[model samples]
Target: MLQPLPQEQTIMAETDRISQLPADIVDNILGFLPIEDAAKTVVLSTNWGGIWPNLTQLCFAPHFFRRLKNRYSTKHAAFYVITKILLQHQGPTIRKFEVDYYDSKTETVKSRSYDIDQWLLLVTRKGVEEIKLHLGSQEYRLPDCVLSCRTLKSLDLDSLLVRPLRSTYMLPNVASLRFRSINLDFFSDLVLDVPSLENLSCEECYEMFHLHIIAKSICSLNIRYCSGRELDSFIPVNMDLRSIRTLHLDSHSLQNFVDDCSRTGLPLRSPALNVEDLNLSDFCFKEETQASPLIRLLHICPNLIKLHISLWCPVTWRCDSTYDDEKDIPSVAEVDRRLPELRSVAQRHKRLVTLKLILFKGFWCEMLFIKELLAALPSLQEVIIGHSNDMDSKRKCEVMERVLHFPRASTEANVTCI
Candidate 1:
């Protein structure tokens, strides 16, 4: 083999290595870029010209069109660019398609509904697996084609209206479903039939008067800031989550379920017996009434191995008077009386190994709660404590020292305070 001359070697070193990459690798790189940036690569070199048309993922985010020349409005620009790309795309399959239009006006959404429907129709025909649509707070009825798309594996919708579906429509392959700020028609029972769904999340959604989830394959469920039409007439959430393993319920949703159960004389303990990890946010132990619901929720998950509790600090915790030693610290007997339900539940949770407490203020109530948890959980191996930002350096140090001295049920338990 003969070595090249110095001039030839220098020329070889300056060659466009990225442009010379294999077709599949180049397609992947283009797929990760914003549609606009990826489209621009077509002019870079002849090798990249065909790569943009074969991109498997297309994302038309608001910021992508925001940088365009102001010849047209953002909405119109997005419409033109996305339509052009889809029309030019030669890919055999689209793995993901996302349209996030947060700045859409109500009239704009209504006017563009037909365009969105066409987009969905084209993408569904190309076997799109994941579809995410964030069409602002307006209610745009999704095209019927999306409901019957068998190739869809994940569907995320925000601010849309779901009308009653025909019995023939089903999402047979969807494994993950997410909804935010959606309005559901009374006859729509779409969620009840997703047999392959494994993860379900609903956030800030309302007007679900009779939400029933009956997914047997679901492993994770998250509900946050969700409510029904009328509190007095709202029906309780009915779920058949026998296979659920991880659960998250915010304060409002949990309280609503508890209240509904109480009113209907239904058991507060759910059928989510397989849940091993539980996360409760905005939880407060300041009132005795609050303890009952927490206890009932724990009872629903006997196999829980990890527990995360974010204590809701009231205005009283920030007052200067709350720092007084005599007034702030409760006696041992008082602590037991105030938190008897928690103690009972903690004793029964022998399988629990990890405990996380967030927004800890080191008040006497919180300290006693920590002490009770430390004494009760014999299998607890890790304890993570996140102190509130309101605490001063001196106060944090004092709290850490106090926690370090607490007796642990597990000899190997490691405690970390931050």
Candidate 2:
């Protein structure tokens, strides 16, 4: 029984409704948007400037800034605006801070290291929970303030120097860590004192004399080789995990670890045996390739429920002096013809349910291996075959049809080709 308000007054009321949203709610809404877009909300109303500062997540990736007409000028402008935002931000609590500052050839990393350190220092003071820092070059090292940040719960470092400052440096609360393209040759023991850490991923790291992953709560691990030739000189890496659920090991890394343990007379058993999901990638096979290393690894992982394998086939060119022609090169087939023998290796796994075959190159040897696997595993529930996108559809269909006809021990087993 109230009279309708005037049109302008109704509009004003609607606008006020949005402006009156709780500060935390407004901050959360802004947190989902890129910092640049969040800052643009300042133009919506006078109150938005204060609301933008309350945002808890700050991400400064390449697309967070406006694209300038001159591509070369964007880096400098981005750096300037980023510095200004850090200086102006008054947020007392930050949950996440991610910075992926990739610059073109014109701007050198040496010039931006100080600004990056300053920005990191500002975020560290705000009690940042998760931090991901990816720089353009290896020369830029992360500031000590970041490494020593006790409040951090997650960290992903790429292309940075991560040498420890002292004997007992600690990340008390960190639960997840990832290192990509990092140099760890200087540290004798890369001790992970984070008892809360559950996930660890290390890839493309410099050859370390010793890597001591001492996280007691770790449940998932992934390690891939950076360089294949350096495996011979690698030190025996030790892991003290409680009960890992998932483990992924590339061909070179698995081979190196196994060889190191064999040479040092150290027990090859660990928490990795409890792994239920296993992924093996970058695995190459030749006539001379030894299958004992991979077979032994599978033997230890008796509880594996899922298995993934990606085969690597290398191209070898043999020049003939008699032909005197560079174009007349013979094609080399690398997938081992004896790969069918792997069925014996996998027969012990009575619990295996899912098998994923990735990057299959339509080789007859590979098809034989698949046939053997289908016939050997009685409990197999499903088989996923992943192939290259560029493969001919007709050829792929033919391959799938052939695999569908393979003798399966389980009648309920289904084959999926992707």
Candidate 3:
């Protein structure tokens, strides 16, 4: 038999190259493309056709529908495309499923709510492990199937309304959960029955009167910008966080958490003994207030090894105050009056090894606070001071000099300014 010519051989090799690749590699390559584009690959070759149906991850983004021709309405086109893909998917278990639906008109989303529910039902049956639904401004009610999915390991939701569960729903395998800009008004007391959950985050969510988290295995919890209906009222979070090792809270959430502890008198009974890392942002230290929440957290997390605090400074300084005066350090009498509680808390936190202060303005109050901290924490090994962008070189130098000269309780402590 005569072999093919060199030129002919090259053509055959190029044609067979893609088909010869492993099925997992082909699936990964198709996974990067949008669901519509990945589905269209079926027409490329017989091998490609067989490969796309087994893709484990499917993402139906906004561009998936926007690229279609104007034969059908946007909502209709989206519904048709998603249904076709889910129906044709032959994978044993879809690992991840994401839908980012957005329309300028809110009525469009409302009209297609049923279709969205159907898509979720199909995916849930296929054993999807992760689901991310980012429905734009409109409030779409989540289907009951999603909440009860046993195979789900992660859930992320945004701009949706969560209704109260009729029966006790437990996500046995879910480990990570996140909510952004969600409305929980109808849910008077939201109970998270995730036994295996390890990480939980809530950002900019509102109208949650009470949150009852039953995640005994949770290790990290983050709450930022969450609030209640009334201006002064705050959402109370109730959980047995004895297993938690990391805690992050902004000013709003911290105040709410502190208030909840005070109202229930739980702080005195149970402190966060396992927490090793604590991050607090936008914390205000007023001169008149005798008790400080920052100090309260230090007391709660007694075993903390790392602490990050971002001081919240007022937009406008007092008219009588001078910003450039380096010698304007507060007297010892005044410093004691302002930060009386902090001194006691600092002395008790001997295990704290790292201290980071963000938005350091070298103000009199801030300097005094730093001085007290340096003199108290005997195990502190590193101190990082972050200054504002508008601070001049001269001002930064002045602040650094003062921080270095302040008496240190830990001989190994090194202070750096940036």
Candidate 4:
């Protein structure tokens, strides 16, 4: 008999050890892999053949459907695969299910809508706890069974027009809710009655005229890019965020909403005042010279422990003293113009300890703004300055120098750059 090689002997021993593991242990190992990789295990060994059907989590994303380019091919292939998987699944409960059917073809989306809904119904009925669906551009009305699923703990909808069956939805157990690139018109019907929701985010949604989020159980609320210039004049977005502890808002939307509240005497409640952290971004100081919307947030979030802000400043303000509008750097005279507005709001920030500034371009106006912030927030202990990746090493060094030397109202404040 030919002598067995040492390597071959070791391989056989390892395979035997793995094969001896408990079925549940093997299933747990497979669960850690992506759904696509896990499916390949069926051919690896007999132990995996029955395992796929009992997987607790299923994630069939668009990355696996890349080969089927056109509408018909993807729709047919995805439908057959998902249907077969769900039909063959033997588990009594699925913990999580996520699908992204974002094809460009409108007809393909329409063709697969019913199949997707059926799959959702099947899993949700099986006591799935988390469901995330990202559909194409067309309007895909969600089934009533999914909207009313009491077992669902989390729901995420993206890039689809959601038309609930009824005027109001009551998801009693859902705690985390997110909507991205959705029609904001549905917020009234969708979010009104979700009593257990604690975290909510509406980002990049369109056509938002009025926001009426009044859920008292919410602890974190993020409203970004939804409130814009096109809001209908009659209904101002009413934000009732009394119970929230974390808040993130785009500067322009916050300014617009605040102005509207001021005009109508609508008492814009300082929800950020109660929050532990606040993030304000996506506003250019050049656009407005009035009370800095960002500074206003720092002042109001008195309980805040962390603060993040992103500002647009001129590159030449740090590199060259001469203001060149030709180089996109408004004159230093313009910086002088906005200094008083920034200074007017500069005051003691008693609770802030950590400050993070994103996209530091080293403009003089930004320099003055940082100076004012340092002069105000007395409790600040750490300042993190992050510059854009496009910035060169020399420019990064310059920006670091500017931040390090700025006078600090807090004696222990330290500055670091990234």
Which model scores highest in TM-score? 1
Q: How would you encode candidate 3's per-residue C-alpha lDDT over 1-418 as one tens digit per residue?
A: 9999999999998987987778788777877788877778756767676777788889878777666525564567777777787888787878789988776667766777888898889889989999999887545888889988999999998887778566457899999988888875655555668889898888888765555556777888888888776633343344566777988888767766666556655563225547888888886564333126666667787888998988766757532233235345554355556565777778777789999999877665677778888998888999998987656788778777878898988999989888
Q: In candidate 4, which residue ranges exceed 4 Å CA deviation?
A: 1-32, 41-49, 67-75, 186-191, 209-214, 227-240, 257-272, 289-291, 313-347
Worst 10 residues of 4 by lDDT: 317-326
TM-score of each: 0.84, 0.82, 0.79, 0.81
Q: Model 3: clashing residue pairs? A: none
- Write candidate 4's Cα lDDT for 103-157 as tens digits: 6777766777788888988998899889998886656777778877889999998
Score residue 3 of candidate 4 by CA lDDT.
Answer: 81
Q: Distance from true position, residue 392, model 1, in Å?
A: 3.5
Candidate 3: deviation at residue 343, Å? 2.4
Clashes of 3: 0
In terms of lDDT, model 2 sits at: 0.70
Tell me which residue pairs clash in candidate 1. none
